[model samples]
Every structure is written in structure tokens, then in C-alpha cells.
Target chain A: MNDGTSATVTEIDMRNTSLRDLNRQLHEATSGHFVVTNPRGAHAVAAGIDSDIVVELRGSVGYYAAGMLQRGTVIVDGNAGTGVAENMMSGVARVTGSATMSAGATGCGGLLVIEGGAGARCGISMKGLDIVVGGDIGHMGAFMAQAGNLVVLGDADHHLGDSIYEADLFVRGDVASLGADCEEKEMSAEDVDLLTQLLERAQMTADPGDFRHFGSARQLYNFHPDDINSEVAEARS
Target chain B: MTGENWHQRESYTFDRNVIAEIHRAANTGIYRIRGFGAKRRLPTFDDLVFLGASMSRYPLEGYREDCGTDVIIGEGRAERPVHLDIPITIAGMSFGSLSAQAKEALGRGANAAGTSTTTGDGGMTPEERGHSKTLVYQYLPSRYGMNPDDIRKADAIEVVVGQGAKPGGGGMLLGQKITERVAEMRTLPEGIDQRSACRHPDWTGPDDLEIKILELREIVGWQVPVYVKIGAARPFYDTALAVKAGADAVVVDGMQGGTAATQDVFIEHVGIPTIAAVPEAVRAMKELGAHRDVKLIVAGGIRTGADVAKALALGADAVSLGTAALIAIGDNSPSLEDQYQALGTTAGCWEDYQDGTDPAGITTQDPELSARLDPVVAGRRLANYLQVLTLEVQTLARANGKSHVHNLEPDDLAALTVEAAAMAKVPLAGTSWIPGMG
Candidate 1:
């Protein structure tokens, strides 16, 4: 617990260290503040970190920089690569800069906040995580998203939220095009209240009234029993 | 009757099946899709003959001496490596392709034989997992039913880059097989055909694959072994790359391996034969000095105990069975002849496994059809078959005067045909000369 001593952050130099050893050490550690310096675009930096600690990575990173993250505060000082925080279950991942494709993809639970623009397929196949993107998002944003809330302050590129399910998508700026089965819906007062809280968590400023909400139409897959036309056909046959 | 004396001459280039395939393709405008391995005849273990000890070495007693059969997979990598009583392990077959009972049967049989069984494409089933003492969960390109929790529950993880039947092609689970449970697990609509992606979503090349292995190792705390399985397109390079990618075990699958669904053309045309594939993989391991250190498991058409013995003698640490395993679980039993007749196919001749109307109940998802085969009986049958195979291997080893099954080598074998001699790199019978060797 390190309760006996004053909380001291452990500094690690990433220039000559192995990521395998680094993640292993992180998994074993119960409580401590960790600072990773000179990441130098390392892939899988602090990956699979599951302890209740904090990690500050000080550089642009490569793919899966903080993948499958759980119970930690991971802050990337610069731009992150593909699949950053991918499949993360819990805790927080705050990126000071932008992220590449599939940012926060397939994450179950967590708060992933990107300050700058995100590349294509942001929040793809999201399970339950809440993502707040400050700037623009590229094509196919939240494609096939199953669950979670994606809030984008800036523009969204083509085919946003294609074949989405359950997940709610909110964009403030212009959308190039909407994808199949994803349609705009009336934003209730409840949505605005939720957006305001999420923005406050990300520490970003944006008017909740300006955002437009979009979600699945459930045309291909009907959630209700009465909506199953094929089952009825089979029953009649 | 008089005109029948003049029979029509058939062209050798365009045979009956070729003509039928062309017409079928023309009619359907799609390739012929089916299940099972290559139907065409190819060079196999039958071309090879064992050289029993006569005078040069004394043969061991029939029942007195013990020939060690126990094999330890993932020697240095895994924290808890699997200890197999025999060298034969059950190959991965998905739950969607085979009924849950069939999966359970495979697990029970492999477990009873003191070996391992693997899970394939659609993910782990509780019945299969519960029965299997040692289970290898396959992580495929599609990632269908893939989650971190299932990966954690597995004893070993096999990263499947390719399968033998469709090396460059994707996996196809037909609409008929897409039961409600399968649709839910794969996140697809019910009664719709599904195709697995050819490439992994996250990573790309071999370099990236190496990183993925490292990530998996870290995620599992290095407790379970990570295996890389590849089709036998180019065994030497593929085995070398898999070794370079830091695999605990490397599995090479030849053309004769079965699939749930694939194009018949691909099954017949793609990939090398098992006999041709083994030596190249062995050569790669030998070149890298990783022969025994990193385990080698060969699959495809490994049916009998002699096949297992031959694969081991050819430098593989173990062998895997898929089609044979299905047969053990009563896939084409003669007892199901009445049902097979109703399905319009003879027993042991059914290849339309993709249609999901299997009469034997091993490959069907229909509740009534799947209920025909009992797991306990099927499992016992498979266990008996495995025991016989193990005994046969032990007999061959004793005949060669080898004290252990692993000690069986090329010196105790010779090939009958020139191609077999060249492929197997063994001397021709009654001669000390290998065809290609100087």
C-alpha cells in the first residue's frame, strides 16, 4: 500500500528497457506512482497494466501503448498510435495529443479522453467505455459499436457509426455522412445533462446544446420479440 | 444395344468431375463449397516402409520392455506446460461446426487418453472446457467470441494464421449452421452465413505477430504456452518465421487436414502434402537448432498409430488429428446408414458437412439431429481408438529396437517410391541411397 511513506512517484527510463519486464513489474506492483520517460514511440508501453497506480508516459507512442488497461491513470503526453487503450476494462486513459485508428476499441469500461483529433475507427466495437474526443474524428467512427457513449466535440468523417448497436454517438461539428442503420434522433434534456457531466470529467469545454445525437435504428436486428418477422414466417410454415 | 458397343472416349484433361464442376459453377455462379479434406489421391505414409531390426540390432521383448511415450509440450516457455501421456493430440474444431456434444466428446476422449484437445474458431464452450484436462484455445483472425476472460481460462493459446484446407482463404460458416447461439457469440444476424476475416484486426505482418505473442504472454503472466499454427504452403519459411516470432510450439498443417467449410478447389489445390511438409519444417528447426527445444506438432491425415510414429520419426515432437478425431466420434459410422440414405449420401462418403444436415449428428446443429450421438459413448470410442494407436506406435518402436517412441528415426524407415524417398529424405528399400542426397 505504501501507506507508511509519503507517496513517491517511481521514474523509469524507457530508452533501454524492455516493455515485457516493464508491464510485468506493473502487474506485480500494488500501489505506487510511476513515470515513464523517453518512451520514444515504443509499442505496448505500460501495456496490460492492472494495478491501482498512476503512469505518466512522456512521448508519442506506437500501437497498443496502454492496451487492456485496468485500474490505473495513464496519461500519454503526446500522440498515441493504433489501438491505444484497446479492450481496456476500467480506469482512465487521458491523451494530451491525438490518437490513431481504433482508439479505445472494444473497451468494456473506462473513461478515454483525447484532447486532439482522432484517426479513423475511433471507439470501434466499444462495449461500455465512455469516450470524449475534443477534435475531429476520421472515417467510420464508432463503426459496429455495440455499447458505450462516444462524444465528439469536432467534426466526424464519413460513415460514422455504421451498423451500430445500443451505443449512443454525439457529434458537435459537421458530419460528412451517416452510415447504414445509424440515424439522428431527438436529443432530450437527459442527453444534454449526460454530455455536460462527461465533458466535465474530460476537463473540456463545449456547449451540450450544439451536439447532435445518433444511434442504431435496429432495422437489421430487432431487440423486441414482436419485431421478429422471420420467426413468425417460420412459425407459419 | 448395338450402338452401346461404341463407348464415348473421355478426355483425360477434362474429366467427369471437371465437367461437373464447370457446369456447377456456371449454374450457381459461385465456387463449390464443402467440408472435409482433399479428395484427390496424393503421396502419403503408405509409400514408406519401416525397417525392423533383424541382425544389426536386437528387437525388444513384446511386453517386457517399456517404451516411453510421455511428451512434455512447451518445454521452456510456459510456467505450467502440458504433460501428454501420448504424442497424439486432438486438433482444433469449432463448436459451431461440431455439435456441443461432439466437442465434449473430443475433450473427454483426449483427456482420457492423457493428451490434449483444442478449441477452434467460434471460441470455447463450457462442455468442452470442463471435460478437457488440457485445452488450447485458438485465437483466429475473426476474433469471434474472443474476449480476455476466455483467453485467461485456456491452458494454451494457439494463434492460427492459416489452416490446411484453405491456406489463403477465410473460414466460412454457412447460414444453416448459424444457430441462435452462434449468431449471438459471433455478433451476427441469425440464419446469415458468416466469413471470418483473413487478417487480424490489430496486427499485420510477422514482426507485428511477434509483438502480439509478447503481449499475450504478458497478459497471461507467461503461465500458458503460446503456439503458432500455419498451413503447409511453404513449410521451411513458415516454420522459420513462426520460430522467429517466439512461439512455444509450432504446428504445421498439410493439405489433407479437414475444415468446417471451404472451397473444394482450395482444399485440393492449396498447400503441401504432409509427407512433403514435414521434412521442410524439420529442416527449418534443425537449421535454427530449435528442433526439440521448441516443440513441433504435425497435423493432416495422421490417422493410425503408424502415422504418429512416422511423424515423430520424421522429427516432429507430436502429431494432431482432425478428420480422424471426427471419425472416432462417429461422423460416418455404418450404423447411421439409414439416416445417411435419407440424406441421399452413403455412409463414409458424405462431404456436405457445410450444409449442416449431418445424419451422424457430429456436424449438425439441429436439436433432433445433434441428439443422436451421445457424448459418453462417442468419448469411449475415441479413447479406445487412441489407445490402439498408442499401442501400435509402441509396437513399431519395440520392433525398431528403440527404448522410447521419440527415439524412432529415419534410419528405421525406407521409402518405396522415388518421390516418397525424395520427400521423406529416406533411402529407397534394399538400398542405402536417398534420391536427392549426394
Candidate 2:
């Protein structure tokens, strides 16, 4: 049906739907197998998809998959490339396998769940997204997160929540070290509740009691050389 | 030791003789002069604007009134949209010409003013990006730091065709400023003089430029607005071409604009004055039926609120500062008089930007010179200058019985001289005399 507003679900599968075509169809269509096959590390797969539609990728996807997504469910059957669900405003992006670097980076609002480990710079500059990883994440995870909940099940690499601002970070394993402006804060009951909720949303089985919260120390934003020098002197002392 | 002292003294005398000879040769047309053009004589773009107060335009009661200077360029439909709080912005002074510290100071100042600063022929720096809330990345013909990631990171993209100081000429970053990092960003050999290509490598004309814009828009996903910046030559044609090429805004830089390095002949002789360019650009936009719809930003000899008001009145949506912003950040502060003397120049009046011998550490690559400037303090000074400019513009607008600065019209302007009247295309003061007409 060539109606201005509607398209058939079968129409998507019949054509050699490129990533651009699929994205355009997803933007225009209300419901659609929307099968994206032959995805040879294609980027921005299912990007700008707003409607309540389901998109299935037959193979691995590339960077910024489902970027800036809103109000839809995106299911990736295989491993996802870098920046999966980046800057996503709202919706659910579920990856069945491991994710590459910068998963859910700068996602303002959404639920992103990675079943396996994420690469370096995971959730770097994340603003207000809920990221749950089932396995170990690489170094510099949750860097500069202003406001969001990041739940990691495995050991985090060095500089977790580096220079972060206000985003709640809950990690189950050992952290190598905190970056500048990031500090380890004791987990409270409310934090545990939030962690538990994130776990349940990601369908994770990890216990919330094993997690620790990390946040910004509120330093670096206001720079006073004298205060910094004194702190440096105190460290020497 | 005596012999060494004798040799040192002799060498000093010899060096002075050589310099004198060089100067003589330059004046006599023996040695071909290259770079350091417009900086030789007359007041720079920084000299005209002086901060005025309640006596001239109603000065803000300091903390009582809300004087807003925030402006958003290339917003809504362009490839990249930049949201800035202040109207004053740093003009494009390339990376190869300025030290990293100078660029950083520019960013710090612009950021403090809640405005955006631009990257020059050099690529984007982490320090500049981190400091600035909104950064407009330059896409010059040289493509020094042209990469998809930097373009995506930028709040707005400026496609620079030419500069006011030296139109149709390439940029040269001397070997002195070509530090390891600058070389790396530009992909040039370290310790070697780098010359940027005069024309863009990817595109040649407006038709191709439109495609290039589309490519950039596609890569950045059309979030940030794209601005096409041109030197004020053929303002009507260039402005129309830029608008036709899908530029969200067109920035017209006049002959009075500053450059880090350019041949003396080109700076003084080439390009039209900003006063003349503004009206032509606005006329082009009006003819295209996109006068205010597509933003027109004018830069060249824009110093004070009066100059800014004049530009807006003649049809510029906003004004950008290069030399003036640099001065506000302590480019030639009188406190560095001793250093200026040592450089054989005076503070508040040095223009040998090409020699890489700036005393304020603004235009030099020398580590000792660069370390003189502190980015934090410089940024604060720039913020103060921007605040003063906003207040002055607001005051002038009030005097003209206008609410917003953008509401000012050509009716508010009266040219002081016949030349100014002809050049500005406005009526003469105390008369109905309009130049270029009987």
C-alpha cells in the first residue's frame, strides 16, 4: 500500500533494504520483519527510529547502532560494534552478545543492556542512560557521565567514572583506580534499590549487595591553583 | 674569556648591521617581503572599540540588570548548530601560526563568555574542545585537521573559502610554530614550514561545495549547522552562492580582518572594507528572500558596541571578533612593555605576528614566550570584554528606541564622510547626500 502514512511489514523484507532504506522505512512506517541482512559492519543501523517498531539485524552491526533512538525496541542477535545506542533519547536496545567500545555513549535517556563484555571507552560521556553489562568492561568506562545509572557485573578497568559528574555508577568487581574528580562512595540502601532495579531491567541475576557506587568529587569544575597546590602538598606530607 | 666577549660583542654589532641591511633591502624592494601584511600600519581591528558606559549608553547597574549576549548560530536546519551566549567570537587564526596556548586562551575566553570560538588552519585540540562549551570547527582548503570525528564533535562547521586579510591566498605556518603537535595534527613533517593549499582539495566550486556540504551533513547526521565563511569580495555573488550551497549561515569577513600571517601587500591591498561588504551581503540575502532567515555574520574591524551596532544596523545578524578578542585576552597589554621593547616593538601596538616573536605569548611558538599567558586569566579578561560589548550594544539600541540589538536598521546610521557614505552605501550625516548617485 503506497499510502502516505502506512507501509506493509512484508514490503521491508521483499526489497534489498540497505541500512539507509531500513532507517528510512523505520522512520516512515508505523509497524514493520524489517529484516536488515548482509549487515557488513554497517553503521547507524536503525538510527533515528522513533515509532513502536521491532528491528532485527541478521548479523553484526557497526558504530552508533540505533543512535539517538526513541520509543522502540531494537534487538541485535549478534555482537554489536562501537557506540551502540549512542545518544539515545529513549527506548530499549538489547544486545545478545558482546559490545565493542563506547557502548551507549552519551545516551541521554534509555535502557541499554549488553549481555557480554564491552570494550574500552564504554559509556564514555554518557549523560542519562541506564547501561547494564553482564561481563567485564574495558578501561575508562562511564567517563564524564553527568546523570545516569551504569551497572557493570564484572571487574572494571582503570579510571572508571573518570571526571564524572552526578551519574550513579555501580560496579561489582575491583576498580583499578578512580580518575580525576571521580571518587568511590559507599553504597547505600537507596543505591542498592536502584542497582536492583537496573539488574531486573537488564534481566541480570547479579546481587545488588556486591556492588559499590562511584561519583564525582566535584573538583576540577572550579579551579583554584592555590587549593590544588595545597592538596598536592598535603599528599606529599 | 676576553676573546669570547670580543666575539660576542662583534657578533651583536654584525647582527644589528645585518638587520639594518635587511630593513633597507625591504624598503628598497631588494628582498621580496612575505607575510606580515596589514599589521604594518594603521589601527588594527582591535583599536576602534572602546568600552563605553552610562554616559554614552545606559550602563548596566553591574548586577541589577540582565544583559544577555547569548546567540545561537546555524541553529534549526543547518548541518551543525552552535548555541553561544555572547556575540563576540574568535576569528579563525590557524593552529600552525599560533601556539597551542594562544588557541587555548581564545577558547577559554569565548567559553567563559558563553559563546563559541573557531579552530584555525590547525586541527581541533583536546584542550580547546574541553574548555569550550560550543566550538565551531573550521573546514579550510588545507584540511589540516579535517576528519569525520572532529566534524561530528564540533557544535558547528565553518567552510572557509578565504579570509579578509588575504583573499585567494593560502596560509603559511612557519617552521618556528610547527611544533611536534602542530605538525602531527596537520600531517606535515615536524620542524618544516607548512603551507596550506589555497583552494579546497575536495571541492572546487559552489556546485561541488553543495555536495560536500551534503557529505558533511550525512556524516554528522545533520545535527550541527554548517556555515559558509567567505572574504568580503563579490559579496552579492558569494553570499548567494553560499546560501544556494545549503549554508545555514553566511559569514562575510572584510578586508579589515586580522590574520596571523599574510604578505603585507595582500592585507593592505586586497578585499573590500567591512563597512562596504555588510550592505552588499544583506542585499544579496534580501534578493534571495532569506535576509534574516539565513543568518549573516560580519567580521572585520569590529571593535566596540558602536561598530557592532553599525554592523547590525547595516544588516549583519551578529559580529565576530579576531584581533579585538585577542586584545581583550591581553594580546598587547601595556604591562608587557619591557618584553615588547626587547622585541623591538611597543605594547598595545605590535603587528609582527608572522615573525613568531609576540611578547604576550599570543602569536608566538617560543615556549618561553607562550608560557607568559595563563589561559584561565586570559579567559576571564575576554569574558569581561564581551560583557562590556553586550552592555554597550544594549545601550545603543535603547538610545535608538529599539528593544533588541537586532532591531537596529540602516535608518539609524549616518556616515561621517562622503567616502564612508559611498562605501557604507548609507546617507551622509546632516544631509540627504547618498554617494554613487547624482
Candidate 3:
């Protein structure tokens, strides 16, 4: 079971195994390292792993890879489809290649490191999951993000962090436009330190000072009668 | 004109309610938000009447004969299908929308009745899970308070696509109801207006939903059933899509379904009636050859056992109760008339659930108001109500010469109005003609 690493290894070939058996085994294992080969864009690869195990998918994964993962480590060596690591609670999920829409969506607690770019809504509705992207992210990134830290090493597309709450966004390059209620803020020493630590964890060499911070304006938290008409008009446009 | 014979004319379009709403909108510059279902009437189960057995078919003895009320949901697909003592079950209502005591009572009652209770938009709470024998966890668009550990604790999982009151809109919990505890669970600031997302954050469409269902199945180890719940917008298509998306059961909620907080306009104007939606959903399920295998639970405006029986006859496997269940738990009680009047409304007509000043304590976050409700007492009331409903259904089924409630079919029913006949696809009373059949 040993595969050069100190931990015991369990090898699973996706071509020969059913998705059910793979996840069931992962769920039951208390502690082990799982090496999955030939994932080949299969959805929900390594989803719902609750135990404190480590899973490494060798190839591309389809939608919801490592979804709702808890107390585990899932590393996808290739590109990920939509909603990778979605709603993950307390785990580490890494995508070596780019991820599609809603990566790390609604995650309560976790660390998701994407070595490449991400699609739209990269961290939509994210809660307390730290996502570090090595490359640029698409529009509407971090939309309505509740609580989390999202760090993008490259430029961001338009309308980032629409209707966000509490979540912090740090981007290094130019952003097309800010979303409703999302605004750029001056980077403080704390922001710098947080970004620096995230970068080091993701293994991306970027100066924390180069990144600008963004957060919620908190204007839309409650209903305001006076601003209703204008906000509605803005939404329509 | 005589002193007592004077008359005043009023336009139907500009009625008193309309005038008041217009004035309120003009003054506030905001739409009216409230709770409860549609106030306007539509063709409903009340328009349908069951035909008891006569000389040709012998009826079972009303009190002496046994008529089964038990139902099994998620039979074929799920490893453990839910077994209910009655065909009626409680629908999803959030902990944030209701008091914790109210949630606990619902669980306690459902447990006593041998049925299931569902968790709502706010996610599963310990009170609900601890009290109920069977609990269905709702996977909402918000994912607020959603975690893997809680998902594993559930007996069933319901993927909420939409609600009946506002089919295409998100959920609304006004600032007044968002207490410190609610805020912590939902990861939001206390006393802020909360708007839950309309569409799911991760997936969209049936194709994506299929994958989503698979993920959930994997999460629960395929031990619990997965139900896809849709507001009855386009029931036929939605039911078919849900079946194709790998649901063990389908829940169709019509326009008459209740809400904790929603715009008054949306509640009245959107979606079809419950009776209208059922037949179409049934047709789709039958067409897919997945009719009974994938159980159907219909909701909205289901008050009496007659409504439940009619729904079953129209091809529903079971019926869910929302507003009616709240009534059973003492919401809008006439005993609280004085307090209701203090809030500028009568007890029976009160709909300002968004205000968090509920006199009955069923729908408020204020500790004092919530404390007015005793969980044990409320639970007993709900259990008694459930027992009465079950007895009524049994009486009707025995009269129809059915051994079980599920045996009642469309042939045993007739509609009173032409609209009802057309919508329910049943023949009109005293006539063989069904308006839409020809």
C-alpha cells in the first residue's frame, strides 16, 4: 500500500471502478492516500469524502469534483469542470489546471488552490473557504461571497464580488468593472500578511503589495425605500 | 334618498383592497411583502366531489372495515423508502421563518403521526433532527448552514428548485426576523434583510441537476432517497425533467402554497393552482413509465382530508401540508385576536409574518413571543389534527369501496364546475361531458 510517501496508498482506476464504490471506500477509510487514475472528465470524482484521507485524481474531472468534501485532501492534476469542490466543509481541494464556473462555491471551510485560471462565478456564495488562483478569473467572480478569502494572482474580469458579504478579494491586475456593492479598498498590513500567506500556501510567487483588496459596501444589507427605484433600474440595465 | 336606503357604488378594479395597496405603495415606495398563500380564489379540490359506492358496488363498513392509509415514498430507487402511517406529510418550512419551538413541535408531531418532517432554507437544526424519527434535509440555493455532517444525518434529501408562492423568485426573510442565532447560522449580519438565491449556486437545468443528484447520492452513500421539489410553474415538463434527472420522488407545489415572506403580487399572480398542476404532472410521470416508481407529493391549499383524497385520486402518491399545518400548530389563532388587532390586523386575516411580531409565537424570533408557544402542547394539537385527517380520509376511502386510500381513482370523482372539470380532467356533475376532453 506504500507508494513512496509515508502514508498508505489505495490505487483506484476510474475505468474499472464505479463512482459509487470509489466514494464509498473513500468515506469509510479513516486515514489513507488514494491515487485515482484515468478520471477522464467524470463528474463528482471523489465527492462527499468525510474521512481524513488524501485523494489524488490523475486526470481531468467533470462537475463537482471533491464536492462537499470534509476532512480530506483532493488534488486534481488536470482541468476541472463546473463546481469543483462545491460546498466543501473543512478540506483541501486543489486543481492543477483551470476550473469552470462556481469553483469552491458555498464552501463553509476549506483551502482550494487553482494553479490556472477560473471561469465565471469562481467563488459564488462562498463561505469561509480560502481560494487562491494562480491566474486570471472570469467575470462575476466571488459573486455574493459571504465569508472567505479569494486571491487572484492575475487580472480579473468584470463585476467581481457582486452583492458580496464579509469575503475578502485580492486581485493583482486590472479589473474590468466592480459589481454592485463591491468596492476596492486600501490594502492594510493585515491584508498584505493574509495575501502573502495564501500565496505561499498556493506556491504562487507574487508580492502581496501588488494586489488590491475588494469587499462589500454593506449598502444593500437592508431594504431602503429611497434607493429602490434606482437600484431596480440599475439591475435591469 | 331615504336615510337607511342610501347606496354607494364601487369599481371592482379599484376596490378597497386595491385602493389601500395603492396608497401604501405610494407612501412607502415599496411593494407590499407578506406571508400566507394567494388570497384570490381559483378552481380547487372543493369543486370536486367523490361518488360513494351504491347498489352496483358494495361499500365497506365505515367504522368496522379496515382502510389502510400507509404510503411508501421513494420505493424502487432508495435503499430505505420512507414508510408513513398516513398519506399526508408536513412540508418544508425553515427554522428561521418559524420559532425553534415551532420547528420542534412540527418534528414531535410528525414523529407521533408516523410521517416525515422537512428541514428548510436555513438548514437542519438539532431540535428538528433530535425530535423527529424521519427528517428530510432541504438542499436550498443559499446553502446557508449547509454542511456535510448534517447531510449525512438526514433520512432524505430534497433539492429545492423553487417555492410555490413565488415560482421564479428567491426567499425573503425580513430584517425584523433575522435574530442573532439566525444570522450566525446563515453567515450574515443580524437584523439584515436576507434574500436567498433563486437558482442553485452550483448547477442549472436538468442536465446539470442529474449530476448534482449523483453527487448527493454519493454523499449519502445511496442510503436515503433524493426528492426534487419544484414550484408548479410547468409541472408536466418539470416532473419529467426531475425523473430524467434521477429523482426517487417529485414534489410539485402550486400557487396556493404558503411562504414565510414574499411579495403579495408574486403570491397571487404566479403559478397554477394545485388541482390544475397535479393531472399534468401525473400525465408526464405516466408518459415516462415512471409513474408509481417515482412517487409524487402534491402541495398547496390542501386543507381537509377531502383535498388529500382528491389529490390521491388525481394521481398523486401523497399530499404535503404547509399553511394548514401551521394552523394546526396554532398560527393565526382566534384566541390571539386582541394582540392581532394591536398589530393592525384581525387574527384570522393577519398576514404580516415578515414583521416578526406574530401573536401566536409560531412565526417570530422574539423570545417572549416564541415562549408563548409550548412545544409539547402544540405537538399534541398537530398530532390530533393529523389523526382527524387520517380518519376522514379512511371514511371517504371506505365509502368509495377502496381497501386502501391509494386505490381511489379518477373514476370515483366528479367536478362541480366546468372550470374544475376541465382542469381536473374529471366529468362535470350531472353530465358526462368534460369541457377539455372533447
Candidate 4:
């Protein structure tokens, strides 16, 4: 087992060993992709990895497939379970298939790409990261995004970009309604170029021309007494 | 209008010459005031905590014998959880609001009592950190005096989301109190009104707060425990979120808490009472399956030992004191009645912390006024009060068959009045009434 004292790659056969042993081996291995084949559904397969290594899970995995990843690439070949790629930082996490709700919730920085659909609150409160979802995202996507870029090829759910600030959003499909302080902005050539690069990085073939951008209008930063009085008066009326 | 009432109301009138003479007797400089300064009858935090041991309950020996009062906060998960010798900790009252001597005195008292003192919105002061054995460094939304060096130096980190005195509101320090040093610490212009941002500059909700926590952990290499301090609003949701965000402990401050300077309207009408907030926070911890695993520190209106015992019985791991600690260090004492009167207010009833007209020298920048307070004597008084509180809590705990003060449960408590019972979430007298019971 690599206990942070050594920098070496140690491989183990997933067929002969359990998911727990595989994860342990992967955690111990230094800076290389540990290939896994025919992996049955397993929970917490690769949790708390803090090294620059890659783990390629060949088959579908259970809940929290790549939870609390600090650095490294964790690629799930098939569909993943709940909290897939949760709180990942400074690495590329590419999920080939659909992910459950709360995907990439509170990710500080890193590139998380979902080839298939993602459930509710995708990229919620994403800070300084780039999330590219090829398929549609469920409700409350990019809610309270402080700073990041969320590019969705398909339609976005309700309350998209709620209470967002400075974060860039590009979606090709219909947006139900923009959240408070979030307004639609004209997409420029520079924006198109950025989208093209993001798509290439995420390994998606979506057209940048079809996408629309949304961002914060910068209201509600400071409260005004007149606004509160008006609201109270309206309630009274 | 009655004849008998009219006869009883017969009065004498003073001579016009005598009135003129009295008016002429009044001096022009600092002598025109009638009463003490700031005579408003505002309620302090101590007004809420009534002593519990009266006639029915058994009380322990005040001296000799052991009534343990030590507390382990942020244990297990926090990189550095503080182990205090006493339950009563000093609250975060800023350096700008109080003089350097006052801060030093508070630290000295807390150190003597084997507890910790907190740094406030202005940031860590050398006097506070030097005197305090255990010091809690506060990380406010403003990021004032925030750096990696201070984070590493702190015994614990308290992320202040809000305070009970003004839950949804930010802080405002007027120009009068912002000394050069205070201005330097907060990175603001000297002698100008400073308003701290209510929301955090870097993070939003608990979801993003996790990242901030991780960053702090990385910076400090996870040596000290992280505590999330929130004003008592929706205690259930806030507490649950704090725990979910990987906090080692949660500090829940109730409405009656004192502020160095806040609007009177916000202080009187902003948040829930301290007595009501404790049980709700305890319930939230229980719901998250982190009741005792994650420590709960309750504040606001915590005064004497009986109040400490009652709070512990109601499921608080420990209690913190601010105004009471200040009082023990000679704030609003009757001895300062002359100075208070000169300022048009009375001792034991002053709240003009926003104005720099303090007489006891505790909360002013004027060198002469601040020099009136002796840090060594004030520190001794505060230590004595802390000792009393520890003994009092221990006495009640022993009577209830609890070896340690933390072991006192709700069963050991009974409310005197319906209001007290409802507020404390305990059973009424001569009845089995538990609010959290399913």
C-alpha cells in the first residue's frame, strides 16, 4: 500500500479482488491509471484520493463513485450512482453515462464533464471550475454559482443561475426561467471561441452558435430601505 | 375632580429668585447634566438567567469537593478542538469597541479560569492572544486581518455566519471608535464609519462553505478544530447545514446577546430568545445523528452557575458569556455613578457603546478615560466570577448524580413558570412535559 511515503504504481486485478481492495490499491498507487474490468456495482469505489493518478472503472458503479477527490482523473466507463464526482478539485472527471442528483455539488475547481444527462442541482454553487454537461440538466442547475462556466448542450431546468454572480452560463436548449439577478446576455465571438474550447475539452461535438449565455445583473448586493418599504406597502395593498 | 383629592393635592411654589439662583449655580463645563449618561432601562443578557436552586432542589457544596466543569469542544473531527477547564468562555467583543487594556483583562480572566477568549470583527490583538491560554480566532465575512499566519496561530477557528443581536444584519462601527490600530486591523480608513458585509465575500451557502473550510484546513494543515458560529434563527436548518459542512462544533448565540454597537431596534426585535434557541439547536444535532459527537456551545443570557446547569441539562455541551464577563471586570459598577451622571446616564444602565463617552474606561479610545481601568484587578474579578460559575454548575450537577457538568440531562430540570418551561423546552412543575418527545 502506498501510504504517501512512496511514488510508485501498483496494479491489482479487479476480477479476483473486491471493490474495497481495488480502491485501497488505487489509493496506494502513485500517479497512474489503475484499470478495472467487469466491476460489479460497488459503493464508494474511489473515495478521498489526493494524488495525481487515474482510475478507469470499466463497468457501472454504485453510490459516491468518486467522492472527495482532491487531484486526479476518475473515469466511470458506464452510468454512475448518487453524488458522482462530488466535491472534486483540480482534476478531470469524465462520466460517460448519466449521473444521479447533486452531481459535482460544491466543486471548487476542476473540469467535470458528463456525456449523458445529470440530475438536480448540477454544478450547484460551482466556484472557479468548468462544468460541461452534454445532455439536459435537472432543476436548480448552477444555483448560487459564484464563479465558474456551466455549458449545457441540452435544455436547463427551472431556476437556472439563481442568485448567481459573475459565472458564465451557455445552454443550447430552452431555459424555463432565469433566477434572481440572472439575465440573458448577447453571445459574442469571444464567447463562441471559449465555448468551442470547453466543448473540445469535454469531448462533446455540440455547436457553439446554438448556445445562449446568462449571467448576474449584480442586483441585491446592497439592500435599500425604499425597496423594503415598497414591498411592505405592496403586501399591505 | 373630587374635593378630598383637591385638598390632598395642595402644593407650594418655589420662589422665582431661588430658581434663578439654582440655575446660576450650575457650571458650564461637564456639569449641566441632570442624571447619569444613557439612563435607558435596556435589558442585559444576565436579566434572562434566573438561578434554579431555591427550595425544592438540592444544591452542592460551593467549596471543596469536585464539581467538574471542564469541556471538550470540537473534539474528534476538528484539527484542533479546544479543551477548556471551565464552561464559561468570553464572547467576541471587538478591540475597536473596547480598549486594549479591556481585551487584555478579558484574556487574563479567561486564562485564569482555564477557558478561552475570542477575537472579534477587528481581528486578533497581541494583548488578547498573549494573555489567553486558548484563543479562538474569528473568520468573519469581511476577512479582516485574515491571513495564513494567524490561522495557524489560532487554537480554534470560528466562522461567524451571524450573531443573535442582529441576525440578518451586518455590523456598523461608527467613526468615533475606529482608532488607528483598529483601522489597520480591519484594513479600513481611520476615523470613518465602517460597515462589515453581511454575506461572505468568497462563499455563499453551506455547500460552498465546505470548500472554504477545506482551504482553511489546507492552510493550517488541519491542526485546529473548525467551529461554525451562527445566530439563532432557523436553528434546525442552520445547525444541520453546519454539521453537514463538516464542522466540529456549532456555536448558537441567542437574541439577548450583547453587541459592542448595534441599533436598539435590531437588538430588541431581531432573533429568538437564548432560552428558546438552545433546545432547537440540540434537536437539530440529534436529527443529524451528531448530538454529542459534534459539540454544541450555547451563548446569550448565560450568567450564573444555575443558568449554566440549566443550559447543560437542556443539552448544551457548554455555555458562553459576554456581558456577564464584562460586568465581572467592573463594567457599569455603582462606583462609576459620578462619571455616569456626568455623562447624563447612570451606572448599571448604560448602552452608549456607539458613542465614545464611556466613564469606566472600558469602551473608549481617550487615553485618560481608558487608563481608569486596571487590567490586573479587572482580570482578577473576571476570574473570580468564572470560578463561581464553574462551582455553581458543578454543585447542581453533583446533586443530580452527574459526575461531570456535561452529564446533566433534562430530567434534572423543572421549570418554575410556564413561560420558563416553554422557553427552556423542559417540563412544567409537577408534570412530565418534554417538547421534543415524539
- Native contacts recovered, in order, as a fraction for each? 0.11, 0.00, 0.76, 0.00
lDDT of 2 by residue, A160-230 (tens): 88767668888898888787789989888888888988999899998899988898787644323234445
DockQ class, candidate 3: medium
The candidates, ranked best first by TM-score, are 3, 1, 4, 2
Better of 1 and 2 by lDDT: 1
lDDT of each: 0.86, 0.75, 0.92, 0.75
Give me the runs in candidate 1 sitting further than 4 Å from their true place.
Answer: A1-21, A29-34, A38-40, A50-54, A70-73, A100-112, A117-237, B1-7, B432-435
Docking level of model 1: incorrect
Model 2: how far residue A91 lies from native, Å: 32
Query: What does DockQ give for each predicted structure?
Result: 0.18, 0.02, 0.53, 0.03
Give candidate 3's TM-score. Answer: 0.96
Docking quality category of candidate 2 according to DockQ thresholds: incorrect
What fraction of the real A-B contacts shows up in model 3? Answer: 0.76
Tens digit per residue, CA lDDT, model 1, B1-438:
137654676767998978987766655556778899998898898888889899897788868899989888776788888789999999999989999989999988998899999998888987888999999999887666766677878999999998988787778888899899987776666776666666555666788788778777877778889999999999999999999999988999999999998988899999989998999999999899999888999999999998999888898889999999999989888988998889888888888889889988888899898998899999998999999999999999999998899999988899999899999999989888888797
In the range B92-180, model 2's lDDT, one tens digit per residue, is 77665776777887787777777778888887888878877888889886555555557668888899998888789878766677788
Candidate with the larger DockQ of 2 and 4: 4
- The collision pairs in model 3 are A128-A147
Total colliding residue pairs, candidate 4: 10
In model 3, where do residues sit more than 4 Å from their true spots? Answer: A1-6, A226-237, B1-8
Clashing pairs in 1: none
Query: How high is each candidate's TM-score?
Result: 0.85, 0.61, 0.96, 0.61
